[model samples]
Target: MIFSYFSRRRADRFAQLLDAPDKAEVESNASAYHHDAHDPELEKLLHLGRQLRQQMPVIGDQVRPDPDFRARLRQQLMDTAAARGIGVTATQEAEPDDAPQTTSVRRPGLRLGLAFAALAALLGLTGVSAASGDALPGEALYGVKRQTERAQLALAGSDVNRGQLHLEFARTRLAEAVAIADNPRLLPDVLDDMDEDSTAGVFLLTTAAVDRGEPSLLDAVDAFTSQQLPEVADLADTLEGEFRQRALTSLDLLNRIQDRSAELRRLLPCTSSDSAEVDDLGPLPQRCSALPATDEEESSSSENRDSGSQRGNDTPDTPDASPGQEVTPTPSDTSMPPSDGLPATPTPPSILPSPSTVPPSSDADSDDDSGFLEDLLRIIGDLLGR
Candidate 1:
């Protein structure tokens, strides 16, 4: 029993040698081979027939299978002794061999154990290969999945700012995939998903910035438009129209104001008396005539017309009331130079006569006269009243 135990332990140690570098692989093989050497544990009842053949005394006889009558007779005598008590007693009584005989018994055992260890190592390698194929690249999976989720969120709603942020993330991932993806077929889905929002966001932001005079954003405009998002195009078109009109309007106002410094100064009450130059000397009627119709006012009028149309009504097509007819001060009033350069005595109200002239011809004529004079008088009064 002791010799059998030592032999089994030696077998296990030799098996471990096949997997010297890795503990996990060796442990797995040890667990699978947990039973005894030929364990399908044999029935405890000994097969005396087989035992007798294995222990038969055949020393110096080459121990080859018996082919002669003498050998068969010798083997039968040993079996008969084992079956009857004498051979059994002798086998049990044999002195234990501690060296040469024990070593000889282990030779075949060592070879068998080495064979099993090799088989276990091969199985271990095959399992490792199988496991590695399913192992995911964690960083790549995290980054790509995050990007895909963001793209889905952006496409679902109308949140412009959030959508833009997500679109940028998706775009970065798509660019990475483009550079490294082994398969071209994988590219189109990611690209198409990314384009769904990235194109629109870039278009809107670029056009808005361009209108604000940030020329840098213009770089993205063509690509944005090329993607052909209808909503993007519509937004760009609308903003472009408003910006174009604003620029033109500003230019128009600039021109109008440029040529009308005298009029502006005249309308402003805070002008100093001595600021007037030689060119500033003029009659009030003549100064009023020089106040040309400003393009800003024309734009304002057009805007009014547009608003009125939206109300589904024709705005009265009445022409702008003409500037009031300025009546020069009588020679009597003009001859006297007042303390200020202003005309002497109150000029009759612009819309009202001295109550001495002939009345206007008809209500139509009267309405016209009143509109013109009333407007001019009101403007003049507002200026002086400032």
Candidate 2:
């Protein structure tokens, strides 16, 4: 939210305060801003600012600027200003050694020039960063892109935010790899960087999820892996040999993250992770036992058991035999033997009609069948005697 113009003005104001001729001027300027000169925080900041300003000369001495480069830069600025129809006055030559020196007046033009130079530098950096956003491996601006990512990670407000930034950078690396797919030499390294980012991101996010007992945080991990897995798999499909293996390794990492997220989701319902085991991914969630049956559930189960037992007791023990119908007797060992002393041939049992299909029989019919069986036995004995 801090605009460049506001930042520049603040920096200019601080610089003016730091460059004050004496402490009185600094106090006068501080009073203009309604800041007490004796305030502890203001004193600390001012002290630090003064210390930093004091070091500038030593820094300048250690790293001297190239005159030719400076002249070229100045000429380039003049040329640019001319192109934009702005007048840029040239610097005057130094005065004679014997000439008398007078009190120096602050040059508004010089201040304006410095401001323009700072603005130009800022714009140039902005343009480079914007261009670097899409830079691939071996490109001039790729290093800038990575540095920017590192800065973002360093400035992240929380572990979750840092994890997200890692994943975002990982996606950027993936795109870079895809852009440079033809460069086999660089592709593996890019993929390797992507994997490292993915690991760090997953670890941070998973650790946060576990420590906070918030499985919802894992949604980001799931989303990232789901989207990247297919793309990496496809890339692996198109590659061969070592490169393909490298891509497959990244794919494997994605798959592991996915499985880890799913497992965390399942475990998040557990009340505690105090006894959980730790691994490279973080703590493995402890096995959650089935919850104890609630009162309603226990009551429902008991009612069911009672109903089942009651139903069993209510069932009839024996069905009523229909009147005038003889019940078939089961065969017993007391049956008569063959008269000829030969082994009796066993008759195959016939299929019986169901009770519903049988017609009611009279008692006289049953008595006649019984007598007929005895008559058959007597005729067999008579044949044997003959």
Candidate 3:
């Protein structure tokens, strides 16, 4: 019971660390804050905080305030009061008021000018941010999106928060990729960057997950894949061949990351009988029910190519011929079939008849051939009768 109480207190302490004050007193001896004894949950939280801290962007060495700043302010105040007709010696009082007048007038003007400049710069920065916030992945202002996240990470102090932030921005990148993916000129580059963002986000999430001993970030990835990725996949599926493959390739990369995490596999909703655990190099992770075709599609396509049964290759049978009737020959091109994949085997000259060998016959020629056949049959019949 006593150990449980201390663990609760430590949990409360760690909770406070989540909202740690800017000037909060941290232990000079870090060991004082770290205790080896804890339940699995508490252990996970500690590991999460540690990973988040490590993931946060390192802002360069912070410049501390000058030790004598207060003294400098005091001296400046004393000199200012002495100039404004307070505690002045008789010798100083007779001095021209023009010096102080100039100081007073110029100081206010200088301050006003600086204030205006600062306000203008702030407005400009805000405008840029607003414009960039709505920019898609391939657009020029997309760089602003990334730089903004870098600033966020620089400011974030919690590792858990930082990892989450990375995934959030990663989703934003994906949002952009999906939004502008229909534009052929823009899609390839945006998708490429989207892949990088997803890979990085997954990597960070995995690190945090391992440290925390749970796939906590899986929910976020699932949300992104469910909501945003479908559009990208749909757009890619509309394409005919290689471009479609490129889109699927990126999609698969993301799935591979998900495949490695066991918790993620259990959460996935994809279920294809063909996608069942096979001899996958990716270790045969469970799949979602709605995921697009994977290596299975590629293999199926290869089979289609090899068998030459691809679309537009059907051949019609030749029409039935009457006795002694010659049918008109169709064009060789029409007679033969369309082909794909490997070339059709060639018939050797020795075994094949020349095109001229098949003589063409008109309707008149067929009538003459039939009459001769009738006469020959009649003569044979008469000989048998005698």
Q: Which candidate number would show the highest TM-score if scored against the true structure?
A: 2
Runs off by more than 4 Å, candidate 3: 1-125, 137-140, 263-386
Residue 17 alpha-carbon offset, candidate 2, angstroms: 44
> Over all chains combined, what TM-score does candidate 2 have?
0.44
TM-score head-to-head 1 vs 2, winner: 2
Question: Cα deviation of 99 in candidate 3 (Å)?
Answer: 23
lDDT of 1 by residue, 141-258 (tens): 3333342333233223222343244345434534443343443334344444444334334333322232232333333433333333333233223333443343233223223222
Ranked by lDDT, top first: 2, 3, 1
Candidate 1 error regions (>4 Å): 1-36, 40-196, 207-212, 227-386
Comparing 2 with 3 on TM-score, the higher-scoring candidate is: 2
lDDT of each: 0.34, 0.57, 0.45
Residue by residue across 216-261, what tens digits does model 2's lDDT show? Answer: 8899999999899989988888888999999988887787667666
| Model 2 per-residue lDDT at 37 | 40
Off by over 4 Å in 2: 1-125, 271-275, 289-386
**On residues 1-386, what C-alpha lDDT tens digit does candidate 3 reach at each position?**
46698778876867665445432343322235556433466546756886676566453223333335557667766876676545544346546856553233233455444443333322233555456778876567666555555444433444445545655765676666567655666667766766655555554444334333344555665665565457657767765466677788766765554434433334222312222222111112222221233445455334423322221212211112122333322232132222311222211112111112111212233344444333333333332343
Worst 10 residues of 1 by lDDT: 276-285
Residue 327, model 2: lDDT of: 29
